[model samples]
Target: FDLVELHRSNRATPPGIVLDPFAERALSPADRGGDRREPPDETSGATASRGGSGARHDRLVALDCSWETAERLVEDFAGVHRSLPFLVAGNPVSYGTPFRLNTVEAFAGALCILGERDSAERLLSKFTWGHTFLELNEEPLARYADCADSTEVLAVQDDYLAEE
Candidate 1:
């Protein structure tokens, strides 16, 4: 919940996971050197319930600027980058549009895919239309959550697009 403000010229690497769709890199479990140990069964502990390790400690960073300025803003960043799968926006300004989520919705979607549902819901609850985003993307969110890696996420995203 710590918010660090940075000037556009500042090139210091921000700490933790960064959600940047335009980033050249994509986040994957393999980037963490691969968790070779088998994941516990679904009926087991928090990791099982959450569908993954749920051990992500990097604070997720998101750009709050306009789409036009977003890419330029994060151009110098060198961190773990992840792009959310396709999901429709629920905000009044961008309702029904795909991949145009406001900060809250984007964070929520990212969190959901990371197996952090409670955190996602907490972020979404801040906005009146937040629940709407979740409602509209429930199936895709669930499917994305089940993906083992970014490659799998891309496959699921492709499937969703094909159906659309």
Candidate 2:
């Protein structure tokens, strides 16, 4: 979890990870890219802004800050981007809402969709509400992870969206 320091603060990445304080690569917002509609090619580019084929441990960056500060934290990165697929937010601030995850929840969701369910759980375990988030989103997270391509992921998201 390479959390680039956008400001002077005391936040730290979770234990036992790459936890680099500054990462050179910048990522775009997950929802900004049509690029995610296609599978990520085997390189770091617009399509891989979210977790793509190129989303190796080194490439993964955690924008660990409040959503209010995320804009300054994530300025105009030159790339395509896309949001995490459909899932309810379980954090106390936005429980049961869609796309309202905190830093840990957001990273955990990305991990789950990228086929790292166990790892995602481990990440969320750092928080007290982690299990609640999983309880609310486990099914969709698994479903999104199983999707082979972004097109399929969007299709599944449509199904969940219809429920709203």
Strongest candidate by lDDT: 1
* Tens-digit lDDT string for candidate 2 (2-96): 32223222222211111111223212223222333432212111111233343223233345556666555443222223456666889888998
Write out the backbone clash pairs for model 2. 30-82, 30-83, 31-82, 31-83, 33-81
Clashing pairs in 1: none
lDDT of each: 0.62, 0.51
The stretch of ten residues in a row with the least summed lDDT in candidate 1 is: 40-49
Look at candidate 2 and tell me the lDDT of residue 138.
74
Worst 10 residues of 2 by lDDT: 12-21
Off by over 4 Å in 1: 1-13, 24-57
C-alpha RMSD values across all candidates: 8.5, 9.0
- What's the count of clashing pairs in each model shown? 0, 5
Candidate 1 Cα deviation (angstroms), residue 46: 27
Predicted structure with the largest TM-score when compared to the true one? 1
